[model samples]
Target: MDEIVKQSLVKWPNVPSCTGWLLLDRRGNWRMRDEAAQASGAAGVAIRHEALLGFINRNYEVDERGQWFFQNGPQRVYVELGYTPWVVRLSVDVDSALALHDQGGGGFEPAAVFVDEDGGILFADRAQPARIAVLHDHDLEIFSDHATLADHDGSLSGEFHWNAQLALPLQGIRRDDVAARFGFVASPAALA
Candidate 1:
């Protein structure tokens, strides 16, 4: 959390939280959901300012209820997730490593990785502070080179093919079960 945001909490401690106004899209973009956008059921407007994006990223946090939010000064603007809490990207510095760049900030340590029926790769740490996350689509190809990937039934193409000889104890699970199984809410109950 940023010092300024921390100070705001102390200065105006009772500012009610704001929800349905901010969203972290699957592609790792911060979106602002306005009244019109919400009514129209759109993905809302994209927030393109670098400074504000950095500020939100710096102050992003999750409450005890597992609701991720951006502490915009004093107001807790809960974010609606497009995938999991964090979006893992392929590290620019490394050739075969993944980087977590989402509400939880940088770096990821996925104990297990699996592909959803829709081809989205899911990572679950299952530790004390477990993270049920999705690897960014753009970097999926690079990840295929890892010897532990699971692509049985020969459904995958190119480097993502199933190689029982190099499998890594992979398992299958549903995306909707992520919150309940991992104890986090993707979309929390509306605030009164």
Candidate 2:
């Protein structure tokens, strides 16, 4: 595994249960096979093991290079190239910083929270609607709104690309939790 993937796994053990490989092209673009992208929803996307604790609402945009920017209310979080595969995971951590990890189970920590199914959808194909995950941390009174899947055909290096948006409310986490640092991780698919 690449250092990126190893570091990511060590930092956040709950890798998103992706069905196929998610790739970042050399030009810093992110891509997944159409089938894989289609299968992976916001739920399947990776998240911060500790993020289920706060309130978060954010948006995202991806350039041709696959570089990503997350806008949460007035704040903007940037994910550099080569770290696209860990976007979902980072969303969770960002939420935790806001103190949204409230719900538990489903392979997440007990303090971790999730939104109702009606709030979002996971898109398996371009023709499908995007999936969303809402998480909350009751003790911290934090909530997060996240979208994990999207379709991007534009290639930065003749490869596919993908991006997403995540939002969080600073009020959700403790007032002291505002300066939480964010990071990324990428895990390679296991061989069959």
Please tell me which predicted candidate would have the highest lDDT against the true structure: 1
C-alpha lDDT values of all predictions:
0.71, 0.27
Model 1, 18-56: lDDT tens digits are: 778888888778899899976786789899988898898
> In model 2, where is the ten-residue run with the lowest total lDDT?
155-164
Candidate 1 weakest ten by summed lDDT:
157-166
For model 2 the local lDDT of residue 9 reads 51
Q: The CA-based lDDT of model 1 is what?
A: 0.71
**Which pairs clash in the backbone of model 1?**
none
Output the TM-score of candidate 2. 0.18
Q: Positional deviation of 27 in candidate 2, in angstroms?
A: 19
Residue 132 displacement (Å), model 1: 2.2
Candidate 2 achieves a global lDDT of: 0.27
Please, what is the TM-score per model?
0.82, 0.18
TM-score winner: 1
Tens digits of per-residue lDDT for model 2, 1-192? 234444655666654333233343322223334555535521123334343212211133332333343332333233322322221222234433321111222122122222212321111111122212222222211122322232334211111112222221111222122112111222223211
